[model samples]
Each structure stands twice: as C-alpha cells, then as structure tokens.
Target: MQKYWILSLALCSAPLVSAQSLMVTSFDSIAYVNSHNGIQASAHISVKNTSASVKDYRLLRSRIGTTGLVDSNYFCWDLCYPIWVNQSQGTVTIAPGATANDFSGYAYVRDTSANGQDSIWYTFVNTSDANDSLQVMVVYAFNRYVSNSESSLPLLSVYPQPALAGQRIYGIPTDALKLEWMDLAGRVHQVITQNDGSITAPSAQGIWILRAYFQNGIRTTRVLLR
Candidate 1:
C-alpha cells in the first residue's frame, strides 16, 4: 500500500506561489546482495521544473523497512540506510530555467530477519514551497524466486557497453550465477557472488576486461571497463 502527507497553504513560505511545477525526467531500480542482507532499490532520479514561478523544495521525511536477521555482522548493514533527504534538502530554490540532475539513495534489509521471513518496503516524501511532493519506494530482499522453468539457462548483462570514464560498472545475471572479475593483464580483482551486481573500474584509468564464469563450464562475453 502507498502513503502520503498533505500540507496546508499556511504551512508554506509566503513567497511560494501555487504555479510552481516539477517534472520527473527519469527513474530506475536495481537489486543485489553483498556480505550480509540483500538490497533491492529503484534509484536514478532526475527532475526539472517547467513552471513559470520559482520553485523551492525539501526532502523532509522518509519511511524504512527492517529485516530481523541476527548475524554477528548486523551493524555492517547500516551503511545501506536511506538518508538522501538530510543530504540534499535545505533551501533548494530553482529558477525558471534551472534543473536538478542527480537524485539518488539506497535502503537495505538489516541482518535481523530470518531467512526468507520478511517483506521490506520504504517511501521517501519531499516537500517544496510550491507544495509539490515526490515519493520514491525501495525494496530489499535476500533472493528472488522465479516460477518460470521455460526461461533460458541464464545470462549476464553489463551496462554502458562501450564503457566510459568515472562510471561504475553495472552487471546483472538472468539466473543463479557466480562471477569472477579479472583485469587485462591477468589479475583477479574480486569475485562477485550475487547475480545482479556492480563494480567500479580500476581507478588509474585504462582499458580492463571482466570475464564472468558460471557453472557447467559456461562463460559469458568479456566486458570492457574503461
């Protein structure tokens, strides 16, 4: 179920008019697991204001879910907390031709839930002088189950196909898969145990190749991380 909060005009700034507007240009989501609890997210938010009047907004409130896993490393997952509101909101005033390009954050399940024992959900709400509201939802999980047996054996996908500078490498596997990341000169960087995942390229800036291996001696294409 979805939730929301409404504000009265008296609560807003006097200079903010009703004509201010907001436009969402992009939205996306992703899921994965690292050393402990897994996280599923929908991020990558970009917005614009097309209204004639100036717009001011603040990300003031948020809702987060919890997992009951009680492993010894429970505290390690706090880094996954969602706090974009505290970092991005403050007197964010935008002019008629102005824009905000980057808006993103993460929410994850803590190591307190029994395996396969919980459903996670969170919603972030923002407020602006124009009374505009933006809400985003994130879900975290351990693993995904599929009922379809007719799907292909399994596949891996790497994004930004050509690769670019200062960009994180994004990858996803279609089925249960294990991955090995290697550098061009035959060095094993790190092994990814999860299906849907991402890794940063070598910081020095050069062409690097990633070879992902799966069970049954099957191998996917080599990716260029530049």
Candidate 2:
C-alpha cells in the first residue's frame, strides 16, 4: 500500500551493497535521554575488520516503519551527515585485526515540551560483500510525546497559531465540564475545572494539544505559543 511504500523509502535511501566481512562490536542497545535538557544524544559503536584482507566499510542509517521516534537522527562514519543523508559519502578501510572507533550515532529531541522514546539503527556494511553487515539498535529512552486518542479528537477553535504571551480562550463554552491543556504525549500542563472561557499556555513554546472534557466525549486542538 501507499503507507508501507512511504515507510520503506524512509528506511534507507541508499542501494544495498553490504556484507559481514567486518566485525562490529555492539554497544548498549538503549540510550537514555532527557528531553528537558534540549541536548543531542549519541552512541559509540566500534567496528573492526574480521577478514584477512583490509575491509572497506560504509555506514548507513535506517529509520523504518514505527522505529523512528526522534525528531531527527543520523550516523557518523568518517564524518557526520545530515539527517536527510542516509548513507555516508565516504568509506573507511580498516586493516585486518584492527578496530575502528570512529563510528558514532546521534539523535535529537527538537520538541522539548513532549517526552517519549525514539529508536534508530546504524549499520556498517562491507562494500565488497553481499551478505556481510552489522547493525546497532539505539533506543533513545525519553522520559518525555502524543496520545492517539487525544490526536483523533474533534478539533476545537483556538486562536493564534503561535499564540503571543499569556493565555486566551475562545469558542469554548464556559459551562463545559472542564478544560485541560496538554502536550502531544498527553502530559497535562494545566487544567481548569472552572473558568471564564480562558486557558493558560505552557511557556515551553511549541505545538501543544488542548482539549475540553464534555459529557459525551472530548474536543481537542493544537496551539503554538511564543
């Protein structure tokens, strides 16, 4: 289907040319990250040439299906490439029995307001072989993201895409059950069980999902604040 095709393309943009002639020493599968720090997370994965001959290896990044949870991530072989660049433009030739510690994988949390885990894979491929390669799974365990139910709720009318200063409410009935302001991960930032059609926006300055509890269900919409 169209959905799967898009995911397949997002996995790895480079053509397949890899083998297991190289030995990749794996690191901790999980990388813990704090979204509140607003810092980039990185993992060090070392590779060694296991074959008798000098092995040339290329590093590739693969973000497939629901595996990508971070805003952006990439790998570093000889150099670091942008997230858009799936494969390294250069390859490193490792002498037999020699290990290369120059490989490192990185990920970022652009949305500090929301907290959730993300995963990305780094693969070291032998440029000359067809069945030789090694992969590292870096699961960024974020202590911070969006709820499926809240995202699927009916859209409510909230003014200002990038809401300037303070908090304002509009189109919401004062008699509603209650109003709740939350982030994409369903973390409640502010809540008002009673108010005069007004809600407070968190100072985090990003897209936030706002909702109101109704008798039957709930209505939700996203707001951006300065």
Q: Write the per-residue lDDT of candidate 2 for residues 73-150, one digit (tens) a residue.
A: 655577657667888788898998898876755555566564556566677877787367876655665543221112
Off by over 4 Å in 2: 1-19, 64-68, 144-226
Query: Which candidate tops lDDT?
Result: 2
lDDT by residue for model 1 (1-226), tens: 0111110111111122242365555543333333132222213344566767676655432434354421111100112222322323244565676676434332233432323422222212224442455444433333333111221334445677657745777755544355555443334455666655665555545555454444432233345545
Please list the C-alpha lDDT of all candidates, in the order they appear. Answer: 0.39, 0.58
Q: TM-score of predicted model 2?
A: 0.52
